[model samples]
Target chain A: MLFRRIYQFLIVYCIGLTCLLAIKKILVLSDYVIPGIPLILDTFGQVFRGYFFDVLNTLSVTILGQIISIIMAFAVGILGRKSSWAGSFVKVMAYNIQAYPIVALAPIIFILLGDGFISRLLIASMICYFPLLLSVLGIMASPVKDIEHFYIATGRMRWQLEVKIRAFENLSKLTTVIAGSATLAMAGTIVAEFIAANAGIGYSIRIALYQSDLARILAALFMIGIVISVYQGILETLGAQLKTKWSAPKEGELL
Target chain B: MHLECDGLKYTYPGAKAAVIDNLCFTMTAPGFNAVFGPSGVGKTSLAKLLVSRGNRQESCISTFDIDTILYSYNQERLPNWSSIGSHLNKICPIGKETLKKELIEIFKLKPLLAARFSQLSMGQQNRVNLIRYLLQEFDLLILDESLANVDEALRETIILAIKTLFPGKMFLYISHNLMEVAKFCREILILGESTKQRKNFMVRGRDYTQGYTLDKKAFDATMLEIMNAF
Candidate 1:
């Protein structure tokens, strides 16, 4: 497991590092020193401190969005399981959400809600809503034919379904959906900031652009990327731990 | 008809040759009846048909109208199937630890219930699943080639458990094990290529009187026979 994680890290790290080097080289070749490397790094640190709550506020929005989406998805999934008619509606709504880019709509949301934390939060929540719903419901609804017979012969009770049946699956599934939603919300916050607020990371990015301070802009962007990565890492670990707990112990794995 | 299927047929979505083809069978109330067939035959399919009834037969059909299924062949939406986890509460369902304890105690699913379905040694879940079904007081209990997944020792324990529970109920016991069929089932439904038929024989009575006529007609020659003593 450790090795698998490291390999995944190396693959992502190499690509990111190579792209940064190529871009840096291009800027230098064009006779743009931009700024000292140390100065860029210090600016990045400043960006982190400047909008730590911006990141938190955005994350909170993403989480709230996911929780709400799950409730909606689960309701529709259960209804679809029963009525067959509802499935088409669920599919249509899901498809419509997927087709329209939430980030593109973030500016409109900011326009409606007005500047700062609340607007960004609303934008992030809207951005995150669909994917979280789709992912959680998809896993919950998927049927495995092999295990059906067991339920038949034993006449498994209704309440018993969640424990032996649903928990293990839902744990991993919701974790993954929440992780994806977090990334979307964070990105949405940045885009929303760019359009509206002058306080958060996105606004900082705009200020750098206005001043022709390309290095500072990159620094702010890089800081946002770091926040996303760190959030993903925390979520990944949370997912794994929840999965381990939910998974029924294999006989050999038992004490 | 307590349990009857005439002109019953089923085919998978994209397969030829009906797993159950123009087959007809029936079972009376208050005892055990075993279904004997080779591995590829429609035993499991038939079991599904039976459980599909007591499970939610009314929602599917007003009565045991097997003809309703003739058109439903290869269709995704069957009349009788229930939604996923219909009984489960969507919000704040109980934890797995409690679920295992209930299944183990109530259904008699012990070590097997404690393991994940994927990690379980192949046949372990069968016993757990079977006992789960057994706990339900359905009109008919369908065991479609059910014990095929269980180990020999556990199979005996399950069979014994079923026998103990055999009061005022019927078992549609499906198996490829011909000797077990002969041993346990008094009324046997025999599925042939051209048609379906029945033969009544007791393991004790057949040897005592009929001189084991089904011995010559045994389909599973190499199947491990359940020793009558054990």
Candidate 2:
């Protein structure tokens, strides 16, 4: 899984770089517009270590933000699984909160929380939480009628068991959603850094954009893509393991 | 314990006509009783009404004396993420190991214990589904075509085993097989043939569980009576 993710990202990055180089050649663009291969290579050699650390910083925040969002989404999803008035209210509130654009909300959040790790974390969590909450809500609210009826019929149904049954039945879907949200979390952190933060790859990219250094930007893009890809791959592998372990046979199950 | 329905009328939401209209019956004895009817004759609906924990203000079906009524059907599913053994272990109440073991042996579910629910064939799945319910505590269990996919020999074996093991408890065996119902079930409740003629009533069945062998004359007469209801 990890190898596949890395190769897929590498392929996409190569294609993008090839297109940029082709455009640079056809337009006779200056080094400022699009750096030549040597310049880009030299810039990569100089900034590789720094950008690598910067991306690590961004990734740390992304992981933390994703954890927070995952907890929040599951909590809300479980609470809103029923079709009661409270559940409907929660659904409406979630949809309404997601309606306002995150870009527009970023400034207000920064103003209140300041352009620090907390602000970035909050922004990242906000970006990752809604889609996840929606998916969790969808999977939770939809009853696994086939399994649930037995519990209900036997008068043994409990809220916790209900949640476990639904989550287990839709484990693949939950894992896919979690893996997909990693990108959103990383993007959210980068956007936060680009707008105001001073220490991450996003901030570095902003500085490079201000200096009109296309080579540095390209290097930064490469770092972000590879790191996010690796993170997503790890998550997917973990999900697969969970599914296998769940379905694995129990030894001497007869007892 | 007695389960009686007086003027039971149930119409599904957005449904044009009542599925069960002014239905009335009383089950005074406990054994392998059945609710039998043709396709789309509301056998399932009646089963649901019998075990439903919903509002009873408008419902004429009464099982207030019964503590718990379980309903099991053919298409019911077990949780797929765990093996059938794990599922049974999780749901099986304490001090019921002997009963569970007996049921597992009788249902021939021992081999499939380590298999996940999705890995089993339909017949295997049905056996596992039924076993879980049998392990649970209930006053009356409504088996609504719960053994539809199993072979006739195995189904009969399972039915006889159930009748023998849990003789004291009540079981409502719902099925399309009139012969099976007539032979094994103590009593049969037949619904009307079609939606237009929705008559519901009860008929006595040969209690083969009571050491009565399959007498051809008695079985034929019972079959004819059950068929004539439809």
Candidate 3:
């Protein structure tokens, strides 16, 4: 099963790469140049190299920020579950954060953090935090009814209850949020790069737009799509494995 | 051990009245007891209050004293039984292997252990839910309509298994099923409907039993008499 999944992922990645190349070729053939611009094909190698490094930069920030945000969310979720007042407070805060538009918040983040990796990290984390936090909180609050009361009555500690019951019961949901947050994190990273970064794919796009280099811009967009798709694919595969391991088989199916 | 709850009063949020009002009851161990009433008479609430030791915030000034109470009302609350060993390990910890093997055999739960709780039929889920509690030691076991979905034969087997295996423990079988109550319990507590009046009454389970079967008509008549007397 693992081998098959890996094979499928490779096939998808290759197909996406081929499509990107094909689009690049079509644009090059059409001589689609902005007015007063020279038709320069010699800089193709430089553009590719720049795009690659920019994606790497953005992804590094995104991955780190998302990991921290997920941990924070899980912690908050547990705290909220343990206490009603804390749960209500966290829920209200999450709601306000979710209601606040990312575009509006972006400028404030830039102004506060001042155009660096810290600013980008903060932006990405904030964008990915609410959805993941809410999802985790919802799963935590989901009552297992008798089983939960049974645990409490049995004197199972909070962490023990979380691991033995909540974690196992809500494995699928947690995986889903992880996948969703990956996409959101990538989007946030790009938006942050567009707003504040001197490096990364978002910065590349900004440069391409300023130069009226449509192909470079297209390449950056395609690279973002590919990165997000690959990330989601990895998470989806992990989710499937978790479900198989933790979830019970359906009726009439062999384990 | 004895289970006791005194002056219990509970009102659901956004509701006009208390579901359980000024209720009091006590049951000693090594006993089979039943709490019965019509739907929405706070039978389930009483079970919850009992199991939680009256810590439910919805209840006003309710207090209960029970060392360990294991309660089950519905199948949906149960965890997936796929990893029965792991689940049992968390709740039982000691003697889990022996208890697991015993329960699987007595309840005929071996076949269903590998299945998800959702995949099992309601009867199967109910049986598993009840068996889960049996693996642990508890002062009071409040099964609030826990066996409603199980078939008669299997339910009887489970009740018999509990009787034989855990003779010293207390079992509070809360249900609207009069026949099951007649067959199992020696004492029955009838919860009253009125919030303003504490009209609860207790009677011997034999009073509702007619020969080999539960006399529903006789039970209803007695219930009516008790309600009117209050």
Clashes of each: 6, 0, 0
For residues A1-255, write the lDDT of model 1, one tens digit per residue.
Answer: 334444565667558656766776777633144555676567667666665665555556556655665566666555444225576577667768778887777666666877877777667666676776566456555653344333433334353463235434457666777766777767666677778875667777788788887567666655555566676777778788767655534335532
Residue A136's lDDT in candidate 1: 46
Per-residue lDDT of model 2, residues A1-255, tens digit only: 988999999999999999999999999999989999999999999999999999999999999999999999999999998999999999888888888777678999999989899999999999999999999999999998888998887778899999999999899999999999999999999999999998899999999999999999999999999999999999999999898788655553422
Candidate closest to the true structure, highest DockQ = 2
TM-score of candidate 2 versus the correct structure, residues matched by position: 0.93
lDDT of each: 0.54, 0.89, 0.72
Write the residue-wise lDDT of candidate 2 on B1-230 in tens digits.
67888888878999998887888888877789998988887888888888774555576776645777888888888887767898899889999999999999988889888888877888898999999889888889999889988999889899888888887788898899989999998878888854546487788998786355778998899999988885
Weakest 10 consecutive residues of candidate 1 chain B by summed lDDT: B70-79
Decide which is better by lDDT, 1 or 2: 2
Question: How well does candidate 2 score on lDDT at residue A76?
Answer: 100
Measured with C-alpha atoms, the lDDT of residue B205 in candidate 2 is 90
Q: What residue runs in model 3 are displaced by over 4 Å at the alpha carbon? A: A1-53, A84-119, A250-255, B1-10, B21-29, B53-66, B93-100, B113-119, B192-200, B207-230
DockQ of 1: 0.17
- How would you encode candidate 3's per-residue C-alpha lDDT over B1-230 as one tens digit per residue? 66556677888999998898777776655667888877788988777766665456664333234467777766445566455545555566675778778887888778766556666677777777777677777767888878877788778777777776776777788887766675567677888778535568676664221224656676665556444533
Q: How well does each candidate superpose onto the true structure, as a TM-score?
A: 0.71, 0.93, 0.74
